[model samples]
Target chain A: MTLALPAAEAARELVEPVLREAVARLDPLTARVARYHFGWADSDDRPCAGGGKALRPTLAVLSGRAAGADVERCLPAAAAVELVHAFSLLHDDVMDDDPVRRHRPAAWTVFGRSHALLCGNALLTLAGELLLEQETPGCAAAARALNEAALSLMAGQALDLEFQGRDDVTREECLRMSRCKTASLLACACSIGVTAAGGPASLAGSLAAFGAEAGLAFQLADDLLGIWGSTEATGKPVLADLRTRKKSLPVVAALTGPTAAGRRLAELLARPEPLAESDLHDAARLVEEAGGRAWAEAETGRRLDAATRHLDEADLPADVRAEFLHLARFIATRDH
Target chain B: MTLALPAAEAARELVEPVLREAVARLDPLTARVARYHFGWADSDDRPCAGGGKALRPTLAVLSGRAAGADVERCLPAAAAVELVHAFSLLHDDVMDDDPVRRHRPAAWTVFGRSHALLCGNALLTLAGELLLEQETPGCAAAARALNEAALSLMAGQALDLEFQGRDDVTREECLRMSRCKTASLLACACSIGVTAAGGPASLAGSLAAFGAEAGLAFQLADDLLGIWGSTEATGKPVLADLRTRKKSLPVVAALTGPTAAGRRLAELLARPEPLAESDLHDAARLVEEAGGRAWAEAETGRRLDAATRHLDEADLPADVRAEFLHLARFIATRDH
Candidate 1:
């Protein structure tokens, strides 16, 4: 509650230019795709301004600075993390068949799956290329982190997709899925920050601890928003996850819970047809009634607290630790 | 015909260890995927008989050696190119929906699309990582070349995919696609070889020329086998491209040719359902009647000759260009 950190300002200053320079250097075709994803330009190489929040890159650069590293020196690593995040989003939107993104048409809907696929792949390659240009041990270190993060993201997505329509989803499974899908990348981001500073191994451990806790809290907030957050606040329909029959943590908990709503939730899930808006609202109410909402919110708060404690223990500069303090609190509280 | 170039063999020797060493360093999950792609292990992680031709890496290493660079020094660069080729194949199969590859189930099919996708992406990162190591300027150079190749591959694939439904695919378009999908990597191969050798820019130019020619010849053989060869010969069905209505060189040529079968070829392609096996056989016959196979085969021979000539003109030690020489002849003449 007492976040006195300037994470947003620190991130903006650290990342904006590195991203600019990275895209500027791409070949014509790749640059076009890179530019498009960054909201820096359109498909035809014209400039635009709709790219989403540069969250991962910000985490990366800040982590570096927090670890006593020159943020500028680690810009490529930061850029690589951002590129990887963008690429993942591009493909994920397609696979999920989600049409709108960043308040506009998703890449697949606009350029078609073929071009979207290419653009996604190009970002993946471009990220490595960015890391590949770094001096000394940074290139190899960044590449390793990025590779692991990518693999985990894919695996987590696969698990999520696999859980679709399966009523037997366990709490443990959802936790594992969340860890892979969210924590791995955050962990990677923190690791990249550590790499930037050539920080001690403890930095790696500490940042990952912060990242893991933040990641779990972030997912909890996402689930909470799915059911109860405002549409403007979340940029998605309230209870969109329920409408789509997603096996979110709250939903899974409610489905298997011992309450009147729990049995009804199971029956509704069994219905093959798309849920009506009224049905979605009822489902959210049922999940909340089954204590899913309160449980998730409490867990989120606990994790955020843990993350802050880790930041305190990380031995980073007080000012830099303050930034993580703000970010961790923000993660638990964000609507989207 | 007189390749006698020891360069290719030396390059091969240099590449295997570098690649093996890189793979040895992979984290458990990544190592699993890496081994599968390298042909050292199967989808389930069981040992396999062969991995690949290792063509691209060999080209990089050999070109460097032939260009008078130290073969030992260029190992990572060579390995990087090999990784790029493997990465491309993994993604290409997914895009094409090809079920089988490398004498096994396509990586995507075996591992599921999500896992396959990540695996390919991880390999791509590894390729850049291998190149970006501190001791090697070739890392950055290879990264640039590999990225260019990746872009070209995507462009070529897009063009190839787009060409599928269009009856008006031109010879020039097909040729350009070939250059992008095939020649660019090969050209990168040869160019990287020289870069490893610490090139004169002139070395890059000549090597690129050689690569361009060789790559064209390489694809030409593939074009031929796509129509004339059997599954046993090519490990894929003969007339398979036509069956899938792929806008391959032979198919494009037949469409443009002035003949009765050419007209019928267009007519059949216009049909909505997939071409029946019997219909595919007929389509193949019609392409022959339209002189499609002959034209493609002739082009293969011509390009092979040109590739050999480039090596000869480079006037390197007999062994330096030897592998490429053999590879060229093999591409033109192999059953597959």
Candidate 2:
């Protein structure tokens, strides 16, 4: 996904140094694991151009500006949110047993499960340490927000794990899990910026709402990509989610869809054997035919609209609001 | 181990409800996992009598009193320390791939590794949440201490994992691991009480030192029990550490000793086959013959003495000093 918005790009650049400094505070062993995971260095500690898009930190920076706070003053909040994101990624890799992330072998694959797990724990504590180090007017409130978000994130992950290999998982359960697993941290990322800046609680709450909707849209789009996006773009094999039998949004929607195609999809999924390449191709087509693709597309648009409404209600400065608008659009439309 | 000291018993009783309340703050799924792990409930949620001796929380409460604060005011800090300890146990069980804990199936065995891991993460965040809820004097300092301890604890666990299946691990490395994995949290437990109570830095530092030495003594004693203690008393299989080829203090001591028995012990450990009962017995005998048993005993005594000296140097009230001394002795002497 291209970051066409110069302001978003600038915010990401602004957050990079703060994120590096915060991660650098970990002990040597954990720091190596974290740095390798972040794509800052290879497993051997050589430099590599690897890492996520820094979307969450940019959201924090923009939210701080939208709340009339200096972006510099909101840096700790930005770093804390990014650290939480990294912590989740590390743990999620282990939980999903994913072999690859960001087009490379996952951290757990390189460092071993135990080291990856401990490094994730260390990163989590470091997030709290960074927030406490802020030592500013609203640091306590920001810390509280971050901790609450972290609890919800883990709870969401528990629910996701619970849903695995279960045939009865409902659409409502999937949506709630998504909210907890993805949306909660993103919402916190938006709100913590405002709280750190000592902005009005109302604005913070509104931004959180905005972010929650944006996060849902983001996840829905990702679910679509998991099944239908190009392998070259996603850095994953074709229909990788289908191969793993992952009950992602689109798959769940298709399984629960009250149609012949949906029933056929269920029968295909319930087979004891692993899905072959031909089976995956058929499953993808069945998901599309079962209205899963259309449903997710509609939901993504609906959530994006809801997110924009929250942003509008937040009454941000015109320029800041436009920047947020661009970001929300980017999240909803990004292909990779 | 019986709590013969009246004050130690009182401190434990006082901290129990606070710990329960802090854990109760977790979301329903994580709470169920944590409750099951703590032996508060069976896997099916039926009531059960389970859990560790509330050692860490009692230490926090007693340390607060020794630092000239009311035990009631130290409840949050006490609960936070206990939660951290429980978090470590849950994750450690996963890392060790152990099947039982406290004479029951381990949490990961019942709930699966993902649930246990997430529950541990939830408990950790809850500790931060509990400390933040205090909003009283010195809360930030207490939170900082807890975070630091958590980082050290994870680092220590990483080191322990690294040492596994490796024969070259040194005595110094084992001691450093013990300090980080066990003593760091204990030290935090002690210092957090003083920080929570707004006590002097000197007293806090001294109490932390006392706890560090006590923790080392406690671990050394535990290593002895792992080899020679009764199965009924320790609620573990005979020579459990040796069965797992764990590089505990005594084992490392035996391996590094410059003697024929030590060399023989190393050869036995290097074998690919699992140790039979007779092999375990022989290994135990060799450890003693190689002077591991005597060395650990002497070191435990030295640490206990050093711990007592730190406690005395803190200038606590005579009554409080007596209680701390009694607790330290109990820790070094406990079997189960």
Chain A only: TM-score of every candidate?
A: 0.92, 0.97
Supply the global lDDT for candidate 1. Answer: 0.75
| Interface Cα RMSD in Å, per prediction | 4.0, 1.0
Give the residue spans of candidate 1 off by over 4 A: A1-48, A67-74, A134-140, A165-172, A191-194, A197-205, A252-279, A315-318, B1-82, B102-112, B129-144, B190-209, B253-295, B312-317
TM-score of chain B of each: 0.91, 0.97
Predicted candidate 1 versus true structure: per-residue lDDT over B16-48, tens digit per residue: 777878777654555676687677887779887
Runs in model 2 lying further than 4 Å from the true structure: A1-4, B1-5
Q: Who wins the TM-score comparison?
A: 2
Q: What is the C-alpha lDDT profile of model 2 across B55-79, one tens digit per residue?
A: 7887888778877788789888988
| Per-prediction TM-score to the true structure, in the order listed | 0.82, 0.97
* Model 1, C-alpha of B4: deviation from truth (Å): 18
Candidate No. with top lDDT:
2
